[model samples]
Target chain A: DQQVKQNSPSLSVQEGRISILNCDYTNSMFDYFLWYKKYPAEGPTFLISISSIKDKNEDGRFTVFLNKSAKHLSLHIVPSQPGDSAVYFCAAIEGGATNKLIFGTGTLLAVQP
Target chain B: DTAVSQTPKYLVTQMGNDKSIKCEQNLGHDTMYWYKQDSKKFLKIMFSYNNKELIINETVPNRFSPKSPDKAHLNLHINSLELGDSAVYFCASSQEPGYTDTQYFGPGTRLTVL
Candidate 1:
């Protein structure tokens, strides 16, 4: 079963605009949400994260908003740049000692010039 | 210096063969993990070792085994490789085992089984 889901397979946004990537999870046990950006032939790099206690977390141009009631989270990039174009994976940390990560299928975001 | 590194960026092997992928981290982190990314780009955790001790072992196949000789090294050994086993394997390291710690990932090793 896919505990985390990214409905959109791809997204396109122009540079200097905003880019939003959405993710949803069915597991209520997940208390931490994270976003990772990946390039082709490379591993994923951490972007932003949010805890269940907080509704939003921001780091520079990247911001992550979490809604526990909706079981959803989103990553927003302000004034998206070409460098922001990459595959974004939304992951949630399962509540337990293991603290394992469950990832979504990922969304390919393209920032147009 | 590279934070995390994996040897043999690409590997092609025939079915029924055994192969090992080596991983090392220089960040002095206590936790290391192996993640498998399939064709669908779904990254799943395979195994994790913290301070040279096995911590998380997911529902991976029996043919796949993970060994951590120390806190900075984690290796994945696959026996009797199958076509379905082909995927990009990534090694990651974190200061701790939980989600609060940011994990750093290696470039990844792409394994192809024929």
Candidate 2:
């Protein structure tokens, strides 16, 4: 079973615009959420993260919003740039001793120039 | 210097063969993990080691084993490799045990089994 899911396989946005990537999870035990950006032929790098207690967290141009009630979270990038184009994976952290990271299928975001 | 590194970026082997992938981290982290990205592009956790001790062992087969000589090194050994075992393996490290909020990853090792 897929505990976390990214419904959109791909997304397209123009430079200087906003890019939004969405993720959903069915497991209520997840306490923290994170987003990772991956380039081709490379390992994923950490982007932004949010705690279950907070509704939003921002780092520079990246912002993550979490809604526990909806069991969803989103990553928003302001003034998207072509360099921001990459595969984004949304992950949920199952706290406690398990401390597992449940990842979504990932969304390929293409930023147009 | 690279924070996390893996040796033999690519490996090709025949079925029933045994192979080992080596991973090391210079960040002085106490936790290390192995993740496998399958053909369907699903990244799943196989095992986690903290301070040279096995912390989490997922539903992986006994043929697969993870060994950590120290907190900075974790190795994965696969026996009787199967075609389904072909996948890109990644090694990651974090400062806090059981806390993966911010983990660094190494360039993956792609394994192909014939």
Candidate 3:
């Protein structure tokens, strides 16, 4: 059972444009959500995170919006650059547990120059 | 310097073989975790250790065992390797156990069982 799901397997966007990646979860117990960016042959690096208490969080060019009622979250990157091309994974964790992360299958994002 | 480091970046062995992957973290964090990414790119937690004590043990196979010699090191040993064990293993560390804080991940060690 995949608690977290990234419906889109791949996405493409033009440079200097906005890129949006979507993720959905079935588990209601998850209170913290995080987005990770991974390059080929490397580990997933933490990008941005949002707590259940807040509906949105932003870091530089990246912004994450969460809708608890719908159990959906979306990541937006403004003015997407070529360096933003990578696999993006959305992960969720149940609060007050061991902090075990449940990750999605990932969405490959390609920013065209 | 690498905050989280795992040895044997690539390991290939035949079935029924015994192998081990070592991990170390220098961030002085109280918690550490081991995650496995399968061929389908699904990442799952296999085990977690806090202050050298086992905290969370997932429903992993009995062939896999995790050893924490100290708070900064966690090693995974497989008694009998199988084809299903082929995946990229990652070691991560955090200041505490929970999603409130960010956890750092290593480069990952790719294990191949022939």
- Clash list (residue pairs), candidate 3: none
Docking quality band of candidate 3, CAPRI definitions: medium
lDDT (C-alpha) at residue B86 in model 2: 100
TM-score of chain A in every predicted structure: 0.98, 0.97, 0.99
- Give TM-scores for every candidate, taking all chains together and pairing residue i with residue i: 0.98, 0.98, 0.98
DockQ-based class of model 2: medium
Q: DockQ for each candidate?
A: 0.77, 0.65, 0.79
The runs of at least 3 residues in candidate 1 whose Cα sits more than 4 Å from the true structure, single-residue gaps closed, are none
lDDT by residue for model 1 (B20-96), tens: 99999999999999999998888999999999898989989999999998898999999999999999999999999
Candidate 1 chain B, run of 10 with poorest lDDT? B95-104
Error of 2 at B18 (Å): 0.3
Q: What is the lDDT of every predicted structure here?
A: 0.93, 0.92, 0.94
Model 3 compared with the native: what TM-score?
Answer: 0.98
* List of clashing residue pairs for candidate 2: none
* Candidate 3 wrong stretches, greater than 4 Å: none
lDDT string for model 2 (A1-113, tens) is 99999999999999999999999999998998999999988888999888899999999999999999999999999989999999999998977764567789999999999
- Per-residue CA lDDT of model 3 for B33-65, tens digit only, reads 999999999999999998899998999998999
